[model samples]
Target chain A: MFLKILYHLFVFLALFGSLMVVVSKKAIYSALFLILTMLTIASLFVLMNAQLAAALQVIVYAGAIMVLFLFVIMLLNLGKQAPLSRRSRPVRWLGLLFGVGIGAQIIAVIYSGFIPPAETTAAASVTIDHVARLILTDYLYPFEMISVLLLVAVIGAVVLARRHLVQGVETVTETAEKAGK
Target chain B: MEYMIPGNLVVAVMIFAIGAIGIMWRRDAITIFMCIELMFNAANLGFITLAQSLGKPEGVAVFLFVITIAAAEAAVGLALFIKIFDDRENIEAEKLDLLKR
Candidate 1:
């Protein structure tokens, strides 16, 4: 009973944080709010018997990914832009209307009993040990593929962000020659 | 077989809605990316909820993949954003029409 209340509290906090992420004027605050939301979601994962997921959520999503977001926001110095979109009211309203419409439909589906009830037959929790075994055995191929994807992402990011070394060196030497004359 | 609807599923829907709205509303590229992340988290929440109720570990495994993909995406997307900023001195999505012209 108490745990359910705690879970509900976390859900409320997570929802509020997500809303703030949307509504906050500044990008930095949005990132912070997002981190809060992630943490709450992590706790919700814990409450759902997904302990390994909760740990990864905290360590990777909130810790690493949000840090990357913060670094980008800081690096770009994206602050105090005109909050309002230049898009006319109608176009913007379309987005809001569609979002609400789809959300309502999904909620109705959830309540319409389209989904079957839980089995509750085995009742085995998804612990770290179970996850490890599955990843090593059943999910190994996809796991290897994910690592390759990460490697590709690493190379892609580095190539995209780095400047041409030859051009950089030429610019430095050109400046040096100008200074000497 | 008389189980109540899980409240978390509804919450997941609302979060996804908030994300979609934010993506459309926010102009900043980073904020839009954050909204995308919000949507991903909503999916994660739904997966975990169903996994718990259904007594399956596969959902949690899928959650790990989702997180990994989110991280990889953030890294590459931010780098791309940095490249855009370096070239244009601003990251406004609308202003970049070098191609549209």
Candidate 2:
């Protein structure tokens, strides 16, 4: 009973956090809300008995990816009140209508195909070693490719970020001199 | 647990919906990228949940790949964001009218 209740609670938190992430006006607050969203999703992973995936979700998405976002936002010095251009009323109305139409279609599809739910309980049958074996043997290619991808990304990000540093420095210096005189 | 709790899928769907909306409506490039990540996580959650119900561990393995891809995407994305910001002093996608013609 307690476990079931806990599961529902976590699921509620996950959905609420996701809403917070989307609705927040301040970009930094939105980013922080995403971290909450990721963490709650991690909790959901744990409930589903995906322990390894849960840990990776926190470490990678919440920990690494979000930190990069925060770093860039800070570095760019984005203002909280940055002015945003308003979209035309017709465009906004069209978008809303399209969204509602798609959502209604999805609901209709799901309603038309209902299946009997099976009672599949989480039995602690698989050990860590077993999981490791399946991963290394069956999914080795994907694992290796992902490592290469990360490596390339790291190098690419460095190069791109460096390209701007000189220009940013020049602008700062020019602005400083103007202010001093 | 007899009926599909309906709640299990709700969170994933909500996250995915938010991501789709953000990707469509947001003008900020960085926010769009973050929305993409949110969409990915929503898919990841569904994958793992289905894997667990079916007694499959391979789902977890696939999620690991997702993490890798997400990290790589963020790195390249942030880099591109920096370059764009330097060039235009802004990261709003609508302002980039160079390709409009």
Candidate 3:
């Protein structure tokens, strides 16, 4: 009973943090709110017995992706922009309608019993070792393919950054030579 | 099945919704990317929760795949951000009218 209450508390906090991430004005505060949201979600994963996933949530998302976001925000010095005024009334109404439509669908799914209650069947215990075995055996091909995708991404980033650096150096040289002449 | 709905699922939906709203409304590119990451994390949470509920390891397997994709996204997004900042000295998405008609 205590644990379930704790889980609900965490979920509420997570939801609140996510809302803050959306509503906050400052980019840096929004980023921080996102991190809070991630951590709360990770805790929810832990509650669901997804230990490995919780760790991945922290390591990959909170650790890696968020840091990259922070770096970009800081690097760009994105603080000087005028506050983003609200979009047109029609656009705002459209967004709210869209959200309400989706929420209604989710509620319908829950109420219509389209989704079986979580406790209907006894959950079989799955350990990290079992998860690893499945990954190594059943899902090997997809796993290898994902690595290939990562390799491609690395190459793409390098190519893009290289162009920027090359252009910057060329511009510096051109200006220096012009000054000398 | 300890609860009516899995705790993780609720969290996932909440996080995903937050990210979706941010992506739709935020003007800053970096904030948008962060929102994207939140969306990915939300999906990962859902995957893991469903795996646990179903009594399978497929959830973790999916999480691994997701992690790799997230890494790739971060790499590309960072590179793009750097390039944009270098070119315009600003990263506001609204300012990029070079391609817009």
Candidate 4:
């Protein structure tokens, strides 16, 4: 009973944060809201007995990704922009209507398809060793592929971020370094 | 105990919907990127919840890969934004029209 209450509270917080991210005027605010949402989602993971995932949620999503987001928002100086341009009022209302419709549909799905199953001892099943074994054994090939993908992404980012040297222009970081010297 | 509460999945779906709408509603490119990240987390939450309920550990493994991939995507995406901003002064998504001709 206590766990169920905690779960609902976390879910509410997560959803509220997500809404704030969508509507917030500033990019930094949106990023902060995202962090809040991520943190609450991590709590949800804990409630669901996914300790590893909960840890990763906080470490990866809230820690690493959010830092990158804030770094870019600062680097580009996108903090104070003009207020958002609004779509037509009717269009906005229509979108909201569709959103409510979809939401109702999802509720119906929950009632129909996701009936609660018989309670079991699932909490004792997913030990750390079990997940570790699966990764190193069954999912090893894909794990290796993800590493390769990361390597490629790093190279791609470096190449993309560099200014066109053929144009005889220094990139922002290069110019700043030269100025410091 | 009701093991399959469906609450987590509902939360996941709501978050995902927010991301989908945010991508269209927000003008800033970085904000849109953040929304995409939100969508990724929504999917991750779903995976973790389903794994726990089904007593499967593979979902946790998949969650790790998903996070790593999200990190990679963020790196490449932010770099692209930086490049675009260097070429053009702003990172607003709607204003980029260099290829419109």
Best by TM-score: 1
Candidate 1 CAPRI grade = medium
For candidate 1, the per-residue lDDT at B8 reads 81
Tens digits of per-residue lDDT, candidate 4, A20-123, equal 99899988899999999999999987776678888988988899889998898889888688245455667655665666677678767866866455347545
Best by DockQ: 1
DockQ of candidate 4 compared with the true complex: 0.56
User: What are the per-residue Cα lDDT tens digits for candidate 1 across B8-52?
Assistant: 888899999999998888777878899999999999998888877
Give one digit per residue, the lDDT tens place, for model 3 in B1-101.
46724446655765776677667676767777777877787788777776777777887788889889989989987898787777667677777665443
Q: Rank the candidates by lDDT, best first.
A: 1, 4, 3, 2
Looking at model 2, residue A67 earns an lDDT score of 96
CA RMSD, predictions in order: 5.2, 5.3, 4.6, 5.6
Q: DockQ of candidates 1 onward, in order?
A: 0.57, 0.46, 0.55, 0.56
Tens digit of lDDT per residue, candidate 2, span A1-181? 7778888787777777766665666667768888988998998777666687788888888998999999988888775733332567677557656655654555455456452343457443334566688878988887788888889989998987786445435543355557769
Per-residue lDDT tens digits for candidate 3, residues A129-150, read 9988998899989988998999
Candidate 2 share of real interface contacts: 0.46
lDDT of 2 by residue, B20-79 (tens): 766666667777777788889988986676566656677667777887888888999898
Q: Where does candidate 1 stray beyond 4 Å?
A: A121-124, A168-181, B1-5
Please state the Cα-based DockQ of model 3 relative to the true two-chain complex: 0.55
Better of 1 and 2 by lDDT: 1
